[model samples]
Target chain A: MIRVDHLTKKFGSFTAAGDISLALARGESLALWGSNGAGKTTIIRCVLGLLSFEGTISVGGRDIARDGKRARSLIGYVPQELAFYDDLRVWEAVTLFARLKGVARVDLDATLDHVGIPDQGGKRIRELSGGMKQRLALAIALLGDPPLLVLDEVTASLDVCGRAELVALLGRLSGQGRSLLFASHRADEVTSLAQRVLMLEKGRVNAEVPVNQFVAKLGAGSVLHLHMPAPSRALAMELLRGHGFAPTLNGVGILVPVPATQKAVPLRLLAEARLSVDDFELLSPRDASLGQENHA
Target chain B: MSATALETREAVEAHAPGMISNVLTLAWRELRDALRARSFLLYSLAFLALGLGVSYVSAASTGSLGLSGFGRTTAGLINIVLLVVPLMALSTGAGAIAGDRERGMLLFLLAQPVSRLEVVLGKYLGLAGALVACITLGLGACSLVLALQGGATEPRTMLWLAGLSILLALSMLSVGVLVSALARRASVAVGTGVFLWLALVFVSDLGIMAGTLAMRLPVKSLFLATLCNPLQAFKMWALHSIDASIDVLGPAGLYAMDTYHDALPWMFGASLIGWIVVPLLLAVVVFSKRSPV
Candidate 1:
C-alpha cells in the first residue's frame, strides 16, 4: 500500500532519518520499531509527506512529492499528538473532520461506535479521558474510509488497559483487510498487530524481521525487577538461573534481564517455585539503561 | 506495487473535497469558535456600550439622549475605532496559526487534504465575519437610537464610517495573520501584534510628526507617511466622510485635497483597500511557503 525508496530527512546539520526504505503490501500491517529519537516518527512523517526528504515515497502508486493532496487522500493519519479544539463538542469536531476528509455522508454514531466511543458526541473534547481522546483521533482518521492508516505512536499516552484495547481494535481493523503502517516501541503491540517489523536505530533501518521471529532476534533487551523478601531473593535468582536465565541483584530487588516478549516467563517460573514476589517492574530497553545508570 | 494496492488517481480525487468546500468548512469552525469565546462577548458588550455612551454624551448638550445626528455620533466614534478596532483585529487574527501551532491543532488541520491557502483564506473570512458582527452590533444599536430620537439625519455619514471601520479592521487583521504565520508561538505572535499596534497607532504618527518638524519635511512626505499607516489612512477617510474639508487632519489633509483634487476620495479609498489586500496576499504567500514540518 506504501513504498519508500532511499528516504533521508535532515534538519540543517542533523539527519533525523537516513536512507530508510521499506514497503507495505495491500492489507498487510507493518511496524517501525525503535526507541525514542530512533527515527520511527521521522520516517512516519516523511511517509505522510509532512516533511521534505530526499528520495521518493509513493502511496497507492502516486508520488507523494508531486501529488501530495491526492496521495494523502488514500491515507487516514493519527498523529502522536491528539490535539483538537477543546471547546467543541464531540459531534461538531467529528462533523468538521468528516467535511474536511470529503466524507459525503457522516454517520457519527457508527464512527464513534467503531472506535469504542459511542455516546461521547455530547461531551466537549476537553472532557474526554486520554483513552477517549485517542479513540476520537482514530475516529477522525477513519473518515472517508481510507484504505491505509498511518499512526504515529498513538498509544504512547494511554494506560495499560487503554493500550491493550486500542491494539486489539487495530488488530480487528487489520484483520478486515486494511493496511496499517504504524510506529511503535512496544513488543506486544508489534507481535499482536504487525506482520513485519522494521528495526530502526540512529536514523537507519537496522533490520527487517518477520513478526514471528522478531522477539527472538531482539534478545534480552528488557529487564524485570522483582522485589521479594531478602531470603527469597537468592532462591529466586537461583531458580531463574536454573531456567537458563541470568539474574542480578540491585539494592532493592532481583533483576533478571529478559527479552520483552518473555517478561511473563520469569514470573511464571517464580510462581512455580512458590517464591512470592512482593512487587515487580518491567523495564524496556530505554528504562533498562536508566536502571543501569541508577545502579552505577 | 500490486495493482490492488494502488488506487487510481481519479478514484483518490473523488474522495477529496473541492477547495471552496474546505475553505468554507474551516471558516465555519473559526467563526463558531470566535462566537463561543469569552473575548467575543466582552468585545460585543464594549462596542455596544461605546456606541450608546458616545451618542448619549454627544446629545447631552442638546438636553436629550438621541438628538445628536449620525454625523456627530460618527465623529465621536471615529477615534475609538482607530484605537480599539486594530487591537480587536490583532487579538482575533494574531492567534490564527500561532495559537493552533501551540496547541498542535495546526498539524491535525494540515494533515487533511486542504491546501495552506485554504487555511489562511478561511481564517481571514471567519475572523472578518466576527469583526463585522461586532461593528454591526455597536453601530446598528447606535443608529436605532438616533432614528428613534429623531436624530437619524446624515445616515450616509454613519454608513460611510461603518464601511471604513470594517475596512480598517480587515486591514489590521491581515497584518495580524502575517504575524501569526511568522511567529512560532502564540505569545510571540501576541507580542508582535502589540508591537505592530503601537507602531501604527502611536509610534508611527509621533515619529512622522517629529521627523517633519525636526527636518522641515515636505507636505507630500507627511501625506505619504500618513497613508502608509492603516490607522492614519482610516482616520483621514473617516474625517473626510464627516467633514469634506478634513480640517481635523491638518496640513496633510489640505495637501491631499490640493494634490488629488476631485480624485482625493478615490485615492484614499484605494489606499485603504490596498492596505487590506496587500497584507492578506503577503500572508497567504508566507503561509504557503512555510515548511510542513
Candidate 2:
C-alpha cells in the first residue's frame, strides 16, 4: 500500500507536482496518465524519498522521511532509463540489488526465472539486447519479492516484442496481487495493467475512473459513421431514430453516438432495415488522436 | 509512555543496517569500479615505468664510492612520485562522486535505502584505497630495484617517499572529489582537475612571489607561504628529508634552509593532512545537502 498527501514539488520557480493526494491499497494497480512534463516522474521521486517536497508519503505503513530504509524495503522501483553496471553479469547485478535491499537468502536464478530471464544470468549487461536489459531491470526490481512496484515510463522505450514481454510480466504481477503504481503515456498499457486510471494534466488530477468504466465512456461518445443511397438516407435516419439513436448528417454519411447500454442496437437496426451502405466508419475518440498522431 | 520513547523503540525495531555497513557496501562497489576502470590499469603501468626508469638511471649513474647522504636514486624517484602520484590520484577522485552524478548512475544508486553521507564515505574509501594500492605497489617496485642496485641506498628516504606519495595522492583525490561535487558537469569537473594540477605543480611559486611582493616576510613566513601549496610542501619535505639542497626554490633558497629548523617536516605533514580533510569534508557537506540532479 502507498499513500501520498498534499505532495507539491517545485524546482525553483516552476511547480512540478501541485497539491496532489492519492492512495493505493494492497492488490490494487493505479496508472498515472500524463504527457511530458506532467510531473509523473516528480511524483514518483517524491514517493521514493529522493526529492525534498511538501507533505508526506508512506509505503507499507512506514513514513518515508522517518523510516526511508524500511519504506524503500517495501518498494521496487523500475526507472524509465536503463540503470545498470554494464560490466556486471545478470547474476551479479541481481545479487547486488538483493544485498542492497537487504534480502535474505536471495534465490538469484529463481528470481530471474520469475521475470522470464532464466538464461541471462551468465551474460554481462552490455551483451543484453534492449528488451533483455529491460527484463533484467524488472528482475532487479522484483528482487526481495517487494510488495509494491513503482515503474516510470517503463514501456516507452521498448520495441514491439519487448513491449509484449513487459506487458506479459506486468499481467503476471497484477495476477499475483502486488500493488503497482506506474506512469505511462500509452493507453493499452494502462488498460492492460491498471485497474484504476488517474488522468493527470499539469500536475493536477483531472479524473480517477475504473478502467472498464473509462472504456465504456470511450465507447459511449464514439460516432458510428455510415452512408446509404442518397434517396434512402431519410429512411435510414428514420430507422436509426426508431432505435433511440440520434444521427447527424456529416458530408455523405450519418454519425451516431452509440451508448454501451444499447448493445448491438446499431447492427440490429441495420439488419432490420437492410440499408446497404457505401461506407461505414466507427470513429472512436482514441482513433481521432491516433489519426492526428499519424498526420503529425 | 512518552512519544519520543515510542518513536525510538520503533526505530530500533526496524533493523536497517548501520552507517558503517552501508558505507562498506558502497565502498566495495566503488573499489570494484576503480579496479575495473581502464584508467586504473594505465595509471599503474605508468607508475611502474616511471619507477623502473628512475631506479635504473639511479643505479647506472651513481659513483663507484658511495657519495652523499640520501643518494641520487631516491632523489630521482621522489621527484617522479611527487608529480605523478598526485596526477593519478586527482584523476581518480575528480571523477569519483561527480562523474557518477553526471552519468545518471547517482540517480540509480540514490534510489536505494542508503543515505547520501554514506554514499560519499563509501566512494572516498574505495577511491582512496585504490590509489594507495597502486601507488604503493609502484613505489615498492622502485625501492626493490634501488636496493638490488647494491650501493648507497637510503631505505629511510625510500620509506618516507612512499608514504608521502600516498599522502599527496590522497590530498589530490580530495581536491578532485571537491571539484566533482562543485561542478555540475563531468567535463567541467575534469577541466577543473587539470587546472588545479597545473596551478599546484607549475605555478605554485607564483602565488608565493605575489605574496612576497605585497609585503616583506621573514624567512620562516616565506617558507611557510611556499608550504601552503601541498605539492610544494611535499617537495620541500622530500628534498629536505634527503638532507640535500634547497637551491631549486629560487631567491628564498638559502633563507628557506636557514629558517627550516626542526619543525619543517611536521609542518609539511600537517599541511598534507589539512589538504586531505578540508576539501573532503566540504565535499561531503555539499553532496549530503544537494539533490542528485
**Best-performing candidate as measured by lDDT:** 1
**Runs with alpha carbons beyond 4 Å of true place in candidate 1:** A220-227, A230-263, A279-296, B1-14, B62-68, B291-293
Can you list the residue pairs that collide in candidate 1? none
lDDT of 2 by residue, A1-296 (tens): 77787889988989999998888988899998888888889999888888888987777766787777767777788888766678888888877777777765777778888888787889999999877787888887877777889998888888888898798888888778789999987777888999998878888887789988756754576767676778777888888898788886655666677775554577668777787777776677566445445555
Q: What would the per-residue lDDT of candidate 1 be over residues A78-192, giving only the tens digit for each residue?
A: 9876898998899999999888888878999999999999999999999999989989999999888888999999899999999999999888887977899999998889998
TM-score of each candidate structure, all chains considered together: 0.91, 0.84
- By summed lDDT, the worst window of 10 consecutive residues in model 1 chain A runs over A213-222
lDDT of each: 0.83, 0.79
**Poorest lDDT segment (10 consecutive residues) of candidate 2 chain B:** B6-15
Model 2 residue A93 CA deviation in Å? 1.3
| lDDT of model 2 at position A134 | 78
DockQ for every model comes to 0.42, 0.35
